[model samples]
Target: MKKPTPYTVSARLYDLISFEWPVYGAGRSTAISLLDLAPGSHVLDMGCGTGLNFPLLQRQIGPRGSITGVDASAQMLAQARQRADSAGWSNVTLIEADATAVNPAALTPHQRFDAAIATYALSLMPTWQTALLTMISATRPGGQIAVVDMRTPTGAAAVWTPLARLACRLGRSDIEAHPWSDMPQRLARVRSASVRGGHIQIRVGSVGRDGDSVPERDAALDPPRQR
Candidate 1:
């Protein structure tokens, strides 16, 4: 099994040290806003480390809606569970599993989710595209699918390129993996945004009905792929 070392070993310190408010938070906030989620909408959060997106998501989803958060790190899920409990959010569900291997039908007996979001998570997986495909399949047709990831800074932000690369390296992410690049081909009504010196990239789009089937390839690799 591939260990999520940063999350597993330092899950508790993640919220404090992850640069949520000053930097990475911008990407999640922007992605959630673009989701255009409706009240009572069921949502899936793939690779939902420490449930950082829960607060913003709950604001829009409300008590009537539900959130299913999945992560590979058990330590991370523990933190997420505590966050939900402390917030008194009974609608939240946290699962320990690889995003690529989770079975949508087994997640909930209810219909497919109204939307799904993955933030700062996909680039860490070698099979990031496969994880994205799973998110699309778990969501209802026409449901929104949003992805937020990172890359080296560009343009006027070029000065921060080294810092950006260093961050990705520490987090065990593929800084060169432009996972969001798949949005145009796999989705509709595609929209995008960038922040943090253009190091963060966000992609949001609607999943078509035909994309709701799991790919034929194996979801769980014998030796989990790495960057």
Candidate 2:
């Protein structure tokens, strides 16, 4: 298999896979449920991927809210645009930029966000720490960051850490070498000078076929097309 630009690999299949697969749907539910905002919450769908979570975010945040979908792929953004146009989602903004390299001031100059969410996108980044930290940086006081990604299984197979090793060997795009397996713990230790908001990170790891939903298995996915 040849390496394709993130957009090329995702454009058609991105929307298809997300909708067709029950995992993405369930995971999105989990992510959107965590937002817990009153109204007018600025939600960031990091790794927005065809804007699968856009509607859910909008519904949670309601009419007073707004969302921005950031993806490194312009092609993916194009597909997302189709969804936005189809649904007439004017509040959702699509910005094409590398997540780790995004300018925080450019994202929200005057105000910070109520929540930041990434579904199945963290593992795709080469520098996930930067990506993760960037999300935290963009958050406002009392805001929350919800990241859902694959976890490195502990002592599975005839291997100890074989999954992570295999992910590394899988090259890059299609497979995630290092996942946010320990985000909850890592976030707890990460000190920020902010006052009102206390950090709460919950790390979950499971060994099941629900890889697509859970974010760890991360196998090559092919979701069906929407009518």
* TM-score per candidate: 0.90, 0.68
* Stretches of model 2 off by over 4 angstroms after superposition: 1-4, 18-20, 152-182, 185-227
How many collisions per candidate?
0, 3
Give one digit per residue, the lDDT tens place, for model 2 in 1-227.
54455557648775554432532355455545544556788887888878888877777777778888888777888888898889877788888888888986677777767777777677678777777766766766446666655433332222434543454344243234334444533333211110001111122222122211222232222222211
* Sequence-dependent TM-score of model 1: 0.90
How far out, in Å, is residue 134 in model 2?
0.9
What is the C-alpha local distance difference test score of each model? 0.84, 0.58
Q: Which clashing pairs does model 2 show?
A: 17-223, 150-215, 150-216
With candidate 1 superimposed using the best TM-score fit, by how many Å does residue 147's alpha carbon deviate from the native? 0.2
User: What shift in Å separates residue 209 of candidate 1 from its native position after superposition?
Assistant: 3.1
